[model samples]
Target: MVSASSSTSSGVLDGFKLVRILDQDPKHKSANLLGEFASTANDGSASIDQAVLILEKTHFSEQFYRQLEDPNRAPTSDGERTIKAPKLDAEAAVLDGTERDAVFAAVSNLGQNDVYTWLLAWLQRSASDPGDADVKMTLIRPATQTHIDKYSAQRRVMVYETPEMYARKVQPWIASFPPSRIQWVYNILEHKKEADSILFEHPDTESGFIIVPDLKWDQKTTSSLYIQAIVHNRELTSLRDLTKDHIGMLQNIKDQASRVAFERYGLAGVQEGKPDGNVRCFLHYHPSYYHLHVHILAASFTSHPGAVVGQAHLLDDVMDLLRLGVDMKQRTLGYSLGTNSKLWSVLYPDGNPST
Candidate 1:
């Protein structure tokens, strides 16, 4: 949550009286801004009827877009480059009514004019007309036309899965997964086949990893292992599609991973805790590659360089949000990209690299 302030500018956008209102955690710096605004008067001042907050795009790149347009472009060897944007349908499923309208408007206006510019004009209209209480105030990143089409045709469908059904249908898929797909396979069950499938001895007491050494650690200074834990008898795509069973599985894995880290690194190794090393578990909402995998890295191990806000969500926070009855899939999240990331061209064409 970034705090709103009477600031003059941010990043590149200038003039128009800028104010930073959304409160944010300093630890999580995002390249893009996704926020919600209320109709309340500015800073409790009657003279200021409305204040518009502007966030300039900082990581724009023209070459990135050019590369995206190149169908024959060579792929980078690093696993990071292999990760594609989450499926458009997955993204569309998370938006609410107001957000859906805003996105639709932005998509519809493409080619006719600059979408962001159009959005600004619409915001101005809403601010001037006091009677338009239904007007929505949300900043949206322009998406591909394919995404827009999928969003338009999307309908809400709730998926329900029982534990027994999950074990029968989903468990086999986990069991047959190749060792190459996992980061490090931990065998919890005595039987090799069973162990591979059951990464944890118990959902509440044990945990295991499906480590992929190919994916480099975000930080290289630390000696701790970078690993991902595999869930048993589950085929969850991401945190947004979590159920009560998924929540329980997540908590159990966290507990087990933390216990393992503490034993290996002691107090001196913990990054978030005092000296002892701790386990840092997180999930990417739209995983670069799809699968329900929980990252269990050592606190000392820096996260992947590509782990930007809006892209990565802490498992603990996901649990807490779900506990509060919030539907994780229905909320919009903010994310940023490095100049070298190929995703920029597919998602943002108008904004070029800042450099």
Candidate 2:
């Protein structure tokens, strides 16, 4: 077991094991399967509860099979194989009704992909439980190699865009700061002196929210208002580079921003018995323009372009992941791009796009 101290920053839980369950490993088949399970979750297709259920059920089945088929298959010689799995409590595998309900409510509305279908076949083969009818049906006709290859080829490629690339390629178009390209970002920077534009300013962090004119509508009739919050610190490019300090700053911004949304949107009159208007903050993993900015829009807004999983992640979820000691950079994040997007050609020069 790799110690947390060896992998993570100080003050994080030392109990958290530094294991790469997503990568293929000869020794730990079950653990490696967990990685695949995580990828399915990150794919933004299924609910978190659905993903967790699949993972736990698969894990249990793998353990059950190992005990039944090879109880004595523990490593005995140098050449012998050892199969290891994550040590999760039996109770933890099952989700309570409340937990399931909450996950269903908070799940991302990202579009589904073929990777999920391919993953079901992989899970069925790994944890073949004869007693389970669903598992049996899934295994009745296994996925063909061609189908597997097709799905694998379509999987999102996570390219770590270096600072150099961002400077050389992404920054040039934005030097003049076109309104069409960046929306309200240029306007906010240039016209912060105007009263209508500047909503809230946090002097300590040099971050603030600006009301977007073109994207805004009457919040009373329509639930969403387009507001952009900018983080003045240029060092942080995207969610991938967030630190504990940055998370703290983001939380403060979120709390204040939500209050602003509640008041500005006239939610008090509309909120009869329901919770007040929510400020849903998110960041596009591959933003249309490169900048350290968060999209602060009303929770009721559904038309925002960055709502999909391949494009966006909720800021709150990103903070929670950091608190749990997940390394965003090391983790394989899923992304999707349009066939016409220039980014696709630049990032994927080769025919194969799987990362």
Candidate 3:
């Protein structure tokens, strides 16, 4: 990445103004253009000629009128084309190092590449409301081999869409893949939901929402990497004679508890092992918690494995149920559950839990 000159202050004149100009051009209104520029800048690439192309494109745009405005453009005696220098907005001046650091820290915990990717995602998501620039960065999933391959060929940016929209457009195709081959898809969906829950309902208060799809979470879930890491940790712990029997007993209890929870809740679906014993596994999204849980039970619990339960999970489940009840009550009273939210409103009689 080209480092901004430390000697110069960071200002919109160097960045936003140029972008705003380009944005006004009909030809340059395409979503991917800015991202293409950004990606080019990111890879320590983008020759001077390439940068010049972007600059030239933006500099000549109709939005450039703002920077070219001149009250003193009256004809002179010589009739020469004289233009008054445009005044810059004082507030839009370059940011000091402290200010830049503050902004960067607020947006990202990861390094520059991750931040850049996140910014691209946000811009694409917020294109509909360019004036509202409050985009938050969540987590960017690591680049897949496809992403890397595509990046080599050309810059790429992933666009964000509403869950319902995304589900309609992408989920069906993704779901068609076998579970193991699409483990990353499941992880992304889970994390996206989590991110949405975090950022949802605050959109009106804030200008926009951003979700950095958690790549690490996807990696840990989709691959055997996490299990291997855990096994290594256990080996190290095993050498210390750290109450192995106690550990074994705890494991057995956990396994049994998970099985009981799964069977009682009708979660058993996939059998982890033979019929002799139950499978102890973390099932995703049971009624207990809106999370992955360790479900355990004996072999006879069911024909397959499903979800799990724990203290936290149980509490979350109860809270969600209560929340649903409250919504149902609001609907019963002929009111909506929340201001400006249409979700779960106008509940029909069939919507009642007893029904």
Candidate 4:
């Protein structure tokens, strides 16, 4: 008797049911498609829930040259534009007599030449950002971490919650987060994502931390060079988990993050007791994901997701609370959560909010 195993975990994207497009970034050529699928739990229970399909276009690479060698071949690029970028044209220079004749013929029609078309298109696109970029989608996956981050634009409810209320509503929700949800977080800490992009790193497993560019930031532009520092400790998830015991870890993250910002990015505020600078390191109570991380941003970035009243808490204030003998567990912590979140339902059982 032949029967399919009760297990429903399959790698194939056969029945990926698309719900809605959560968000899209034109400049980066990335998007978060929020959807769900029918599945079975480990114990073989049927279930359906949200899954983030992280779609990103692969950046231009050496494969682009392979297509040029064949001229008419396009394993990656859709079709030939004689002018993709100045660098590419220089690299794929006309080699021999036959090639030179073909090249001259292709560009003989000045009016219909794709070089003029590409250049005109490039000129208009360059107004947004100064650079040549050639990318076509090759990476798409069902995952977490960054998947939810792309859906940053959402209606958020400010939660003015006491410690007792947190224990009752928030703690259980935090507990429900499984380790499998944060494989991307693990990739960052383990140097899998950006081994070459580490701005600063402290190797100590417990109190140590690492700094890298935030997903939202375009790494090149200093105006948008928003970085993030994540502590090595996996146990610390959010502000709700902070306590007197974690003071040392908090302090180290603050100090290291600030020092690096001052030394490298030339932005400052809390490092040397200066009142003004570009870099501001802060934390979020209702972070997009479960992993504990510190947001370090340049002042020029005016519209980042978490830089608001309920979400952004500067590193200095967080550590100061511990230094001043405040019991974080008992103190009232106010933050925001998406109204669609389960925590919001618990906080506002009645569909209408009082405050």
lDDT of 2 at 135: 16
lDDT of each: 0.44, 0.49, 0.27, 0.64
Candidate 3 accuracy as lDDT: 0.27
Top TM-score: which candidate number? 4
Lowest lDDT sum, 10 consecutive residues, model 2, at 132-141
Between candidates 1 and 3, the lDDT winner: 1
**Looking at candidate 2, what is the lDDT of residue 55?**
19
Query: Which model, 1 or 2, shows the larger lDDT?
Result: 2
Q: What value does the lDDT take at residue 239 in candidate 4?
A: 73
Q: Candidate 2's error at 149, in angstroms?
A: 31
Residue 163 accuracy (lDDT) in model 2: 57
User: Per-residue lDDT tens digits of candidate 3, residues 94-143?
Assistant: 54333342332112122235323222111222324322223322221332
lDDT of 2 at 196: 67
Question: Which candidate comes out best when scored by lDDT?
Answer: 4
Task: Find the 10 residues in a row with the least total lDDT in model 3.
Answer: 224-233
State the lDDT at 150 in candidate 4. 45
Candidate 2, residue 162: Cα displacement in angstroms equals 12
